[model samples]
Target: MKDILVRSLTGVVFIALIIVGLTWNVWSAIAVMGLFVGLGLAEFYRIFQKENEGPERFTGITGGVLLFSGLCLTWLSWADQRIIWIPAVLGALPFVVMITELFRSKNNPIQNVSLSLFSWFYIVLPLFVLILLRGKANFPFEAIFPIGMLLIVWTNDTFAFLSGKFFGKTPLFPRLSPKKTWEGTVGGLLFSLLAGYLISYFSGLDLTFWLIAALIVAPAAIIGDLFESMMKRSLNIKDSGNILPGHGGILDRFDATFFAAPLFLILHFIYF
Candidate 1:
């Protein structure tokens, strides 16, 4: 009972922070998302923690921040689109990875270097996509893009659990996640789709657009959760980290966002 209360309260606070970050100004969005990127990268690197075999934390994190900020600049068009700074940072990151491994005299130089590069893609890129989705892409309520995106994901998560608790019979994938059931997955998708279809009534977004988003985001969210579960299982650990008491880590909280972001980016561009 106490654990349930703690989890519920943490979830509420997490949702509240994300909502404020999105609904506030643009810089706040960058700052808040940037903070997530930084911490998430740290946790991700720590997953492979070893003296020399693990990823280069400082270089990897710095590169991630630069990658996120550069993309934001390109999207915001607040600076010269042709700015060479982005190119310079991108060019230097790989060398930083390799050189750091050389100094470490690490046996798994391949593991260290590759993990750093993969971290940028796995963790950094997805978070950056969230920023892209916030573009005022013809939606009357610009806030709705991020808020609605989050709402769909959250609604699915909530309903899925309720459904599974009450009606779960068949396991979704006993290999990766033993607790997940097909009933829960379907319930979550149905609820998310309904929420997306209804969002048009409350916001300026098109019914069809949101419906499609729900379709994509719901299953993608499940996949994200499963993927992270696989990661933890392979790593021989339980939660990603203990950062968000009861909720695990930033990855545990935003796994859905990571998968949903890129697909939403394509959606935003196509609509534009």
Candidate 2:
């Protein structure tokens, strides 16, 4: 009970900060995202560290900085047409850094390269998406995209847990997540559908778009959750981190959003 209250309070504060920062100014929002990306990457690194195998600390730190820089460049690219150099800047910074890190080490080259590349994809790529969404033209919708993804994912997870506890019959993925069940999944999907409709109605998105998004969001949200569970099972870890009491970590809270947000951003790009 205490855990739930603490997590709920933390979630409220976090959302409040996002809304406040974005409404205040683009830079403020970017700064907030920078902090988010930084902390998120750090937590990911910590997870790797717990396993006794991770990228070189120096290289990882450099990657984190480059990721932040790339995000900033993405922001600048949106603010000006003549300033199209921003994407180029964003691309080159990480590429050069990763390449340099790769060549600097000759031992177990495959593992090192994988770690370097994976960090870029896992840690930095989403931040780049967040920056793009924030700065995209004709998409006042971008701001809502991340928030909507987060909300839907949260709803799915909550309902899935509750439904599974009360009415779970057949396990959905017994090998991966023994606790998940088809009943929970269906209930969660229904909740996500309702969430999508509500967000669309309130946010002025089209009904068809909302329905499509619901279809995409719910399954992806499940995949996101299951993927994290798989990773934890593989690593034999219980939680991603201890930052949020019962919530585990920011990663625990945002696991579904991590996948959902980028996919929703793509949906916005393609359809909205």
Candidate 3:
């Protein structure tokens, strides 16, 4: 009972913060997301460090921050588009990791380098896509699109959990996530579509756009959750970290966002 209460309260607070930050201004959104990127990368690196001393944590974090911040600034027009070259320069980070590993005499240089670069794609890139989504000029209600995306993701997650708890018998993917059921997945999808329609109404976007966004975000979110579950299973741990009291970590909370955001951006461009 107490655990449930804590989880509920934490969820409320988390959603509230996201709403406030996203609606406040572009800078606030960047700051909030930047903080998540930092914390998420730190959590990811910590997991890798447990098995072996991986790449330089400082370099990875710095590179991720620069990439996220640079993208945000350029996307929002706060800075010139040429600033994108900053992230391009930081893209040399993998080589830096390999070179640094050479002096350290670490055994699994391949693994170290791979994990370092992978962290950027797995964690950093998806978060960066949110900036792109926000900054698109044609999208009506810049703030609402990202917020609506989040709401759809949350709707799917919430409904999936509830449905799974009540009527989950057939596993969706037993190998990766034992608790996930086809019933839950379908439930989440339906709820996400409903939520998307509501958001579209509120945001003044065509209902069809939101429906497509829901179609994209719902399954993508499932894949993202399963992918993270696969990672946790491989690492032989439970949660990513203990950052959030009942939610586990930034990764745990935002795993769905990682996959959903990028796809939404692409679809928004192509369809919206």
Candidate 4:
């Protein structure tokens, strides 16, 4: 009972922060996402450090923040999109890591470099894609896309958990996540579709587009959750961090967003 209360309270606070940040202004959205990227990267590096010994935490974080900031600046129109070369240069960070590793007498330089770069690709890049989604040209104030993305993801996660607890019998992926069930997955999908429709109606977006977005987001969110579960299973850890109390960590909370946001952006570009 106490755990449930703590989880509910934390969830309310988390949603409120995201709503205020995304709705307030472009800078606020960037600030909120910037914090997520930084902390997520930090968490990933910390996990990697447990096994890899030397993951170049400082340089990796610097490159990630640079990449994230560059993307945000360009997407928000605070900087010219042609300054793409800045991120282009920043993308060469892995090679720099390899070279830097040569100077150090580390036993697993390759492992360290690969893991550090993986943090950028896995955590930071998906977040950068989300920032791009917020700046979509059709959306005034750059609001609806990001907000809708969160709505669908959150709705799906909630329904999935509830349905699984009540009617879960057939495991969806017992190897990766034993608690997930096919029934839960379907419940989540239906709820996400409903939430998508509501968002479309309220935001005045096209119904077809929003429904399609739900279709993409629901499965992507499941994959995202399972992927994180796989990572934790491989690392033999329970939660990613202790930041969110009952919720585990930033990665645990936002895993669905990481995959859904990028896929939604892809679909948005292809369709919109």
Quality of model 2 by C-alpha lDDT: 0.73
- State TM-scores per candidate: 0.93, 0.85, 0.93, 0.92
| Candidate 4 residue-wise lDDT at 76 | 62
Please report the candidate that would top TM-score against the real structure.
Answer: 1
Ranking by lDDT: 4, 3, 1, 2
Cα lDDT of model 2 by residue, 117-196, tens digit: 67667666765666666654433454776666666777788898899999999999999899999999998989988988
- The whole-model lDDT of each prediction reads 0.83, 0.73, 0.85, 0.85
The RMSD (Cα, Å) of candidate 1 is 2.2
Return the candidate ranking by TM-score, descending: 1, 3, 4, 2
Candidate 3 lDDT at 101 equals 73
lDDT of 4 at 17: 83
Candidate 1 regions with alpha-carbon error over 4 angstroms = 78-82, 136-140
Q: Looking at model 1, which ten-residue stretch has the lowest summed lDDT?
A: 134-143
TM-score of 1: 0.93
lDDT of 1 by residue, 139-192 (tens): 325667777888998999889988998999999999999989999999999999
Candidate 4 error regions (>4 Å): 76-85, 136-141
TM-score of 3: 0.93
Tell me the spans in candidate 3 whose CA falls farther than 4 Å from its real position. 76-88, 136-140
